[model samples]
Target: MLDGQASDLRVFALGTDRAGGMATAAQILGGAGTGPGEFQRPTALSVGRDGLVGVFESTGRVHLFGRSREGELEHRTTFQFRMDIEDGCILGHHLVVTGLHSEHSGVVHLFSTAGEWVRSFGRFYDTDNPWVSETIERSLVTCLEGSDEILVAPLFLPEARKYDVLGNLLWWTEFDGLRPIYLAETADGMVGVGTPEDGYHGTIGVTGDVDGGIAILQVGFITRERRESGSDPEISTYVLAADTGEGALLGRDFGRIRDIDGKGAVLSRGVPFPTLRVITWPPSVRQP
Candidate 1:
C-alpha cells in the first residue's frame, strides 16, 4: 500500500501468513523526493512482468523500479503526464493509467515503462460541466491475473467495464443500486467486486469494504443526521452476496478494501499512516 506522509513517503510490500494475517515485509521501496528513484504522495502501485514496479503519484508522474542483480528493488526511471492519475496497473512492458484528463474521449491512458504514451480509450461520464464530469469520472483500475484484460470500476457509480490491453472494449456490466468502491483480479482471471460511498449522490448512504465481497461499514445519511444532533452513527458492516448482489449484516467497523485475492482481502484502516488488515473469506462467501 502507498503511505502518503510528506516526510517519509514510501511503499512497503505486504506479506500474508497461513492464518490470513498480513504485515509489512522487510524490503522497503521508494522514498520522498522529486528525483528519479523517489516519489511523493503515491496514489497507486502496480507490478508487471520482468520485476517491474510502477509507483504512480498524484502529480501525474510514474516512478519505475526494477530488481537489481542482488534482488533488491531499485529505481530505474521516471515519467510524467499532464493529467491527475487516479489509479493504474502494469501489464507486461506497458503501464495502464486512469485519471482525469481534459480530453473526455477515454479515461484510460496506456504508456510504456519508458514513459512513452501509447494510446487512450474507455469512455468516461461527461455532463458538459467540467467539475461534475471530473468528480463523477473517478475510477479504480486493475489488470486481471493470467491475462491482458483490465477492469475499471467507477468510484461513485455501480458499473464495471472490461477491456483488452490494446484498449479494446470487451464487456460492460452494471449493478443496480450498488456503487463499486474497489475492484480486484481473482487468481482465476475473473474480477472481484468491492464497496462504495454515497457521499456524492447520497443514494446508497454508505462507505468502506472488507473480506471476499463488498461491505457497507457506515450509513451516511443517518450518520450525517446523527452528527448534526451531536451523535455518532452506529457503525455496522453489511456484506453483499457475490452471487445475488444481496447484502447481509456482517460485523462492524473496518476500512476500505484495497485488494482481494484467493486467500482474502487487504483493508486500509486509518489516516496518514493507515493500518492494513488481511482477513480470510468464509467458505460461503468465497467465489468459485
Candidate 2:
C-alpha cells in the first residue's frame, strides 16, 4: 500500500491464509524519519520478483527491503535524489523514478538495484516530440515482466506511452476523453482505468435523470498480437466497461480501481470512511 502519512511511515503487507482466506497483518517495513530505513512520505510501492520491495518517498528517497524468515521487513539499501518524486516502479534490477521540478517540467531517473545511478531522460513541459518531453503529472509507470517494455501515463496528456529499457518511445494511444489514472498488466495484455474528464453525461440508469452521478469511468484493455511472418505487431483494443452514471452496486459506492486480478479487481470506494470493494470484471449491466 502507498504510505502517505508522515507520522506512520511504513509499507504494510496484508497476510492471507493457505486457502486464500484473509489472515493477520504479515509485516510492516520502514518508519518515520530521514534515516536509511526510515521514510518521510512513502508515496509509491512496488514488489519485485526477487522478493524485494521498493518504496519511493516524497522526500526523494528510495528504500529497498526484503522479507526475513519471520516475515519481518529487513532493510537492504537506500538511494536519494533532489527532485520531488511523483511515482516509481521496479523493472528487474532497475528502478525507474519520475520526479517533478516545477509546474511544467519533470524527469524520469533510472538507477541500478544496488542504488547506483544509470541514466535519466525526459525534460519537463518541452513537448517537442515523444522522446524529449515527458510532461508527467501524477506519473503512472508499469513494467511488462520479461518484455523489457514499460508503460507511462501522465495525467496532463490524453495518451498512454510505451518505452523500452533504454528510454526509447515505442508507441502510444489516445483514450479519447478519458484520463488514465491506473495501469496494470494482465494475462491477456494490459488493462487501465480512465476517469472521464467531465462528469458522466450519458443516460442515468433507470432514473432517466441527466444529473451526472458521483462515479463514471472507463476500463480498457490492450492486447498485442504477434505476426506470423516478419511484420509490425498488431494491437487490439477492448472497452471492458464504461459506466453511464450508475449510482452504486451491492450497497457499495464506486471509486477508482486499484488493482486487477484474474477474475476481478479491487476498487477503492467511498469517502469519509474509505472502504474496498472486490468486483468481478465485466460488471453486471445496469437496467434502464
Candidate 3:
C-alpha cells in the first residue's frame, strides 16, 4: 500500500502470513521532503524490469527505486513529466503515462528514464473545445503482458485502444453498453469527475491489464428503480479481451483491481482505511 503522509511519504510491501491473514508492511521507498528520495502526493506505482519500482505523483513527479548491493531498496533517480498523469507503467528505461497531453493532442505520453521527453501518441478524438477533449480523454494506461504494446481506456467512455510503443494504434473497440463515469461530491454538488457530468453517475474504473486483457471494476444500476432510489449499484470486475473488448466476468464486489503482476492481481478494498489483497488469475469462476 501507499503511505500518503506528508511527513512520511513512502510505499510499503505487504507480506501476508501462510493462512492469508493480516498483512505486515515493509518500507520500500521514499521519505519526507522535496529531495530526490522523498515523495509528494504519490498516486501510482509501477514495477519495471530488473526489479525497479516507480512511484508517480499526479503532479508529474516520478521516483524510481531499485535494489542496492546490500539488497535494500534504494532510490535510483527522479524525473519530471509534463502532463496531468493519471496512470503509468515503466518499460525498460522509459515510462509511459496516461492522462492529458503535455503539449499535444494525445493521451499517451512517453518519457525516458533520464528525463528526456519521448514521443506522445494515441489521440482519441478531435474537437475545437479543449475542455471537451480533455474530459473525454481522461484515461488510464497499462502495458500488455509479454509485449511492448500498451492499452489505454478513457474513464468515461466505453472504448479502449491498443498501441505499440512507437505510437502506432493497433486496434480500438467499444464495449457495448459500458459508458462508465466516476461520481464524487464536490463543492458544486455531485459531479461525474471522470466525464464532468453534473450529477451522480455510474462508475467504471480500469485497473490495468491482466492475462493479456484489460481488467476493469465497474458499478452500475441493474434497474431504474435502484438508480432512482439511490440504492447501491452492482459492483463487478471483468477481464475484457484486448482486441475485441469481449471477455468473462471475474467476480462482483471483490474490490478494485489495482495492478496485475506475476504474483497476481493486486486489489484494494474498504474505505477510509483500505486493505490490499492479491488474487490469482483465471480465478476458477467466470460469470456469464
Candidate 4:
C-alpha cells in the first residue's frame, strides 16, 4: 500500500491491477473518502491530508489537485510552477537538480504547500552545452516528507541535500558520483538509489556527454566514506537519508552516481523491490 495526495486528510492511494490498469483505492483513515482523478505518466506523486501534489510532463506544471464534487478529482491551480529549464526532480515538496553537476546554469525550483517561492539554489542561466542553450532537459525526481520539507538529490551527484518547500537549504553532504542511473525512496523512508553497473566509488564521474557506468545503493549520510557488505555486484545501490546523509556503509565497491534513471525501477523493472509495487506517496494523505 503506497500513499496518495488528494486534499488534506489522510494518505490517498492510486492502485493498479495485475492487468496493468490504474484505479484509485481506499484506506480506512481519519481523512477524506476518495481520491483525485486519473493521472498520466506520473513521476513524482505524494499524498497530503489536504491535497495532492505531483509532476506530469504532459501537463508541464506541478499540479495541486483535490476533490471537487461527488468523489471527483478537480484541478486546483494553486501553483503552476515549471522547472524543465534545467531538467530535475519536482515532487510534493522537494526539487532535485543536477545544475551543480552539469554547471550549465540550470534551475531546481521548489514551492511551499501554500504556494510560495522559498529558496533558489542552482546555477545561473548560462551556455554549457554547445548543442543546447540554457535548458536542463534531464530532471531526475523529487522526494518530499510533507509540504515544506523536500530532499533535492540529483541523479548522479555524490552529495544529497535537503531543503524546505520554500527552498531553504537544510543540510548537505559528500558522496561519490553515479551517473546513468535512477533513485527511489522506500515505503519505510529509506532511499533506494541504484544504477546498472557498480561504480559510485569516486572512481568515475558522470557528465552529460559521457556514457559512464552506473550503480545503486541503500545507504545514509556519514562522517566519512564507508563501504557496505554482502551487496550484489550486479547493481550498486545506496540507502541515504533525506538530506542529512546519516547512514551506514553499504556496498561491495564504489562507483560514480548519475542523474539518468537507467533501465531500472525508475525506468522499467519487472517488479518493485522490498515492497509491493508502490508508485509513490500522495501529498493528500499527509494533508489535514
Give the winner by lDDT: 3
Q: How far is candidate 1 from the true structure (C-alpha RMSD, Å)?
A: 9.8
Ranking by TM-score: 3, 1, 2, 4
- Which residue segments of model 1 deviate by more than 4 Å? 6-25, 102-104, 126-129, 178-254, 271-273, 279-288
Clashing pairs in 3: none
**1-116 per-residue lDDT for model 1 (tens digits):** 45566422244544434343445455666667887767776888777646687788878988888888987777788887888998888887778888876553477888877777
Give candidate 2's TM-score.
0.60
lDDT of 4 by residue, 1-288 (tens): 212333222233533344354434443221222233343323344434354533332233344556657765555643334433223344444333323222323345544655565555543224444223222223233444333444444434455555554556666555544333445545664546554444432212121100112123323222122234323223344545443545444563233233222222221221222222333324543213
Model 2 sits at a Cα RMSD from the real structure of: 15.4
Q: What TM-score does structure 4 among the candidates reach? A: 0.44
* Ten residues in sequence with the least summed lDDT for candidate 3: 195-204
Q: RMSD of candidate 4 to the true fold?
A: 14.1
Count of clashing residue pairs in every prediction:
1, 2, 0, 93
Clashes of 4: 93
* Model 2 accuracy (lDDT, Cα): 0.52
- 1-288: candidate 2 lDDT, tens digit per residue: 544554333443432333334333344556677888888878777777577788887788888888779867788888886667877878888988776643323456677898777776653244433222332344566554445555565544544455678877765445453323333334554343343433221111111111111122223222122122322212112221112222223221234555443345555533334445555545443212
Q: Superposing all C-alpha atoms, what RMSD in Å does each candidate have to the true structure?
A: 9.8, 15.4, 5.9, 14.1
lDDT of model 2, residue 231: 28
Residue 279 in candidate 3, Cα distance off native in Å: 2.9
Which 10 consecutive residues of model 4 have the lowest summed lDDT?
203-212
TM-score of 3: 0.76
